[model samples]
Target: MDTQVIVLSVVADIVGLVSVILGFVAEKTKIKPSEIIVNDFVYCDYPTSSVLGMAISASLMLILAEVLIAIAGSCCGCCRTNAAGTGKSVVGIVLSVFSWFAFTTSFILFLVGAVNRGVNWQHLKIGDDCPLSSHLPGIFAGAAVLAFVAVSLGTAAAFLLAATPGSSSQYAQGVEMGRPQFQVPSNGTPPFNRPTI
Candidate 1:
């Protein structure tokens, strides 16, 4: 059960981290091409809708990550049997959960940044009326990268400790093979009467 929990936690952290990275990438790099208008038209200044959408999504994800980390840090304590062990477990759980959040956020942002999956960049043109600056995507993308680092490294460390061998583990405690010995033999001829079992 403990192993399973650790594994799940690690997996979650990774997923979250991946999400965060993708989010950041979507925000930073212009993977999607900006649509070109055929003729000169009345263009309004506006933030790239797709970027804006992704940013908003990433922000929400960031917030969620914080909450999950908090929860993992606290809840993970219950799984530990010792003070030091508890602390380590908490750290591990927190990191794993954080990674998952980061990964998930990044992946979502990436998906959002995708031309068809997310906001349509074609509707947003250069020098158009937009609410956000053109550079916001890059900023979010950077944040996502940071999140990935935190989550991946942290979770990995936690999992390593969790996987450590211990006395309590079944593998470390195997069945005894030696036979039991008796203090005295059942047959005794020296005492006059012999008894046998």
Candidate 2:
């Protein structure tokens, strides 16, 4: 494997782990039923839980890791556009885009799950529900898993892009539409032909 790939993988792993940790912490720190005051309206206690910060931090970490990996992988002409690299680039781009989508979903989930953790508006009856906002721990856990998946996919895509041909650092397919050409050596004699008297 390429050193660049190894480095990128390591960075992604670290970032992913950090995000996962934050997510789990968010889950743990979420508002509990005991912490809620019930009467007519519902609101969190003073100071609130730390879930909001954790969730938002996790989301930010994921985005930062994605951008850093992408920038580090192909910044040196490793992602040049050429026919020789079309297939690889397409697949790589697809994976990268999917990764982005996954992380985006996770970010939204995290945001939603944490948005209500600090609700202080005590005028919402919420249709006889005292919980006001009910967020399951599964939501935070699932979002963390998704963030990990996104990191893995993004690393794979960057590796593929680095492996593509025609990069300034890698072999080029030549100037002919960036396609490889094969030429047989000609010594004025046919390779498989013999003169018959």
Candidate 3:
């Protein structure tokens, strides 16, 4: 594997780990509940648990993919030539691609959820008879940002792995068959003596 590819894999792994941690934090952090009383009825606004759960699941998948890639890259010797090693790397790339999709979806969902929650809070404050204010915790926003970054890094790593040069079996076979790998210069174009036609 190329050094650049290795570097990319490492970066992806680090980002993935960070995203997982942030997702966990977001899941644990809860929005402060506030009540509004109107016409002798009480209403409370709470954070969306389902969205945070999805974020955690997606982040976990990203972490799994990144860890797998890092392990394969470290253990697979001469990935270009060894069929098993090459296959392992290919699997890693596929996992990374899946992780990218998951991360992207998670990020979008989190963002939309946060925005909607904010809008609802604003509407409650301005339009409702009983003014109430509640917003998502900062941890959720941080997790969304981390998930987005993880997607970018994971995608880059996958592309780098896919672009790695594979061993050329045909070139080796040609060399074994005593075939010139490159065209030799003609006598007229070289510094050697040329025979008369």
**Candidate of highest TM-score:** 2
Q: What would the TM-scores of all predictions be?
A: 0.42, 0.69, 0.39
**For residues 1-197, could you state the per-residue lDDT of candidate 3 as single tens digits?**
45555565666666666666656555455444443233324443333444445454555655565555544343222344423346545664565555556565666545543443322232333444444223445546565555656555455545545454553222433336556465557654755558989
Report every candidate's CA lDDT.
0.48, 0.71, 0.50
- lDDT of each residue in 1-197, candidate 1, tens digit only: 35554655555575565557556555554433343332345543222345555555555555554445434333433333342344555466556566556555554544444433343333343464332343334555656775666555544644544543341224224556589654554674353455778
Best by lDDT: 2
Residue-wise lDDT of candidate 2 within 71-174, one digit each (tens)? 64564223555524477767877887888888888888888887756645344445555443455657898899888888888887777777776433444545
Which lDDT value does model 1 have at 165? 36
In TM-score terms, candidate 3 sits at 0.39
Candidate 3 lowest-lDDT run of ten: 116-125
Question: Which residue pairs does candidate 3 place in steric collision?
Answer: none
Give candidate 2 regions above 4 Å deviation. Answer: 39-47, 75-87, 119-123, 126-128, 134-137, 168-197
lDDT of 1 at 176: 62
Off by over 4 Å in 3: 34-93, 116-120, 124-197
TM-score of 2: 0.69
